[model samples]
Target: MPRPKRPGEAQDVGAFPPAEAGITVVDWIDERTSLSPGIRWMLFRKVPKGINWAYTLGSATLFAFLAQAVTGVFLAMYYRPDAAGGAYESIRYITDDAFLGQFVRGMHKWGASVMIILIFLHMARVFFYGAYKYPRELTWIIGVVLLILTLVMGFTGYLLPFDQRAYWATIVGVNINGTGPFVGPFLSDFLRAGPEFGATTLSRFYAIHMLLVPGAIGALIGAHLYLVSKLGITAPPWLKAEPEPELLEHSEV
Candidate 1:
């Protein structure tokens, strides 16, 4: 007969420690999807020397987005898009009734402001660092689009409470959008879902806030990150670039 295993030993041959089991699961999925190499390529990058903390502003902005997404989902569980009275009451319920409702709502609220700030700071970093040139120009454009979408998300989310201030503020916002020259009036009308904030206006904005804009933002973020990983990061602006071959030869001569 085989000897009995010790107490510390695994009871079965298939048994694995948590770390080993995690690796096994990852390997299994990677084998099926052929994703390991892609993941390694994206994550395990060989970057230029002298990379500074300022470069991390992009990552900070990304995390801010993630935080917003999480907190937004939590808020969505309790939010109602009713424009009449249900919307404001739902918000009141979240603030006064639901478990940790106020806390999560606060996160989603204040987090929007934080996300906007982070993205601007990130854009500034990219601009001042001279990383917005040539190969990275598309990335810069995408970032600009994301910035606009973020602003839209903030705008749409602001009206969810359906309070007196929100109602009037949104009216003011739509009017301002109407002043966008030729297309401005049409665009604002579309947003208000007609000539005025009709029955479906809040619902429309809610769908946009929770679904449309977030989906677009996620897709763009994926593309942005892929470009960043593939093209690699630029060195700090103060750092000298490699000299051209002709210049090197001329200098040697």
Candidate 2:
């Protein structure tokens, strides 16, 4: 018969740890992909020390987008996106009963505008830096797609209040959709959820603005960040040359 093992001895083959004591799948994942390692993996890898204020816009834009999403969630709790006293009464409740509702709404509105501007600035910085070349091409393409989605989110958000502006804007939008060949009417029906804008239309836009668009934005951001990590930062052309001291000495000699 096999001898009994000591307290600190290793278990025999085919033995397993107790269920409650065993490591979890999450533990395995954390061990393999811990971002806590340092800044090198999280960010700042290969990024130049001279990165100017313009390079900061991407992070600022992302922060603004997150702030808008959180504020919109709060606003959604108090605002009714329907035709039954929705446009004016909802505004009254937000401005009256809901503490900081007006501020939240105002912040979301202005943040959207700021996010748009910052994203453009960020894109311009990347473009001028030639950051879209070769290995970073997919990130650039995803950024373009994200830009289109951002505009869509803004347009969809503009229709949520059910006011005259929302009504006429959606009407024009529906008309444009209805003008397309073949499935134009179908597309309009799908978007409007009927022949024209109504209570249902308001609810649909609210859903898209609050849920669908944000979800897509989140997914695109993930893809963009993943591509950036995969490619790493591209060094400037000048930085890619021999060291400054070597070049200087060679020129002097």
Candidate 3:
């Protein structure tokens, strides 16, 4: 498929005019995988007539999640899950010594709260707008699952610093979880540990926080988005339903 280059020809293969370059690249990829249509359908599809800022809550919540994920990755670089003072010292070092570590940690710290707030707001919007009806019920259920997982993510991550507050908070939280009927005692025992035995507890929380829960949340989010896209958006409840013109009878035809 190679054409012999003639003398004086430019060697740059993608040196098309700037205006066409983006389209050309897109076309190349689209031809190979037929990916463009799916993307366009997912992103640019029609919405109900009452679409407004409220409809954007899902996107806002998604942005907050992305922010948390990015900052969390950076924080993970300096975080230590050691319960033998190493964990607290690592956090102290980040807060006081590492370059911009405090800022990243702060973002992750505050961003968790922000994400929780946004998801709730998004849930409220869906509920009030009546977007959870019919075929969309599964999407709403998946969203509820995501909300629970997000809370678990926050709870598990809160224990990673191995601070006194985190330690006590986790103990209380585990006690709360341990109230589940059959598995209650086992779960409580799994999470509750003495100061000398806290290493295993810290490790378990760290793994669940950074690996298991996040992975589950990510997968559920994917399913939620897919369902949303497939089911499409519903009109806000305040919007009056209009009779279709096709259904109107003409006086004279």
Candidate 4:
């Protein structure tokens, strides 16, 4: 028990200052926890013995995202997004002039698709297992945001190649946006950077695809990961603890 101080008695002080209270906190935490073969185990935690394959999709999505980021950086080094005829020429340079350009672009495109598939699979797992319950509501919300970002990434990337397919895709995309209810026209105009697809549109898409979209995705992913860490992984709802038969036999003896 802590003592009540007398009139002139010195008050007991914590080992560290209030602002440095974390040091004291660490000291207390260290006393209560121990490492097992280089891994720290939280008190009262029991490692789950069985988990479904759905749990792995989140990891796959993360890997895909990383792959896309790396390949995108490499492609950006040689890509020139222009409404001018130089678009095809620049891409040709990337293919013919830059080292490993074809492989990088292929990897980026394929990686984006893989990310989409993995995210969907992860979401399905969460739904089926009811992992999106109680304390995990925020994680699900962030997952939705991440899904939207993945789509945005796909849309932004569609224009980078600057081919006939890209040109028509942006045209259809802007037209769809232009049909908005209230601020749709404004958003479309803002997105395209002009009334019609031209040099401005190419510049806008390039900036967004290369910098802005990736930045937004990065921020959201960071938040999602932080929340997941805070909430901890949710095991399947149907899961039950199993007793060890060997231990039970020994206890009976």
RMSD of each: 4.5, 7.1, 3.7, 10.1
Better of 1 and 2 by TM-score: 1
- Per-residue error (Å), model 1, residue 53: 1.2
For model 3, where is the 10-residue window of minimal lDDT? Answer: 190-199
Candidate 1, residues 1-253, lDDT tens digits: the string is: 3357998976665554566778888889988999988889998999987898888889998998999999988888899898889999999999999999999998888888889998999998998888999989999999999999999998898888999989999999999999999999999989999999899989999999999999999999999999999899998878888877988987945
Candidates in descending TM-score order? 1, 3, 2, 4
Highest TM-score among the candidates is held by which one?
1
Off by over 4 Å in 1: 1-19, 242-253
Q: Where does the lowest 10-residue lDDT sum fall in candidate 1?
A: 10-19
Every model's TM-score: 0.89, 0.77, 0.88, 0.75
Q: Evaluated with lDDT, which candidate comes out highest?
A: 1
Candidate 2 residues 92-180, lDDT tens each? 77877788887888898889999999999989889988989887888999899889889888888888766778779988987897999
Instruction: Quantify all predictions' global Cα lDDT against the true fold.
Output: 0.91, 0.80, 0.86, 0.79
lDDT value, candidate 1, whole model: 0.91
Spell out the clash pairs found in candidate 3: none
Model 4 per-residue lDDT tens digits across residues 93-208? 87777787777777887888889998999999989888899998988998898898788888878887788898899789888978989998888889888776767788787788
lDDT of 3 by residue, 1-253 (tens): 3366789986666644687778879899899999978888899988889789988889898888889889888888999888878999999999999999999999999989999999999999998888899989999999999999999998998888788899988888887887899988787777655433355889888888888888898898889888888889998888898877776665343
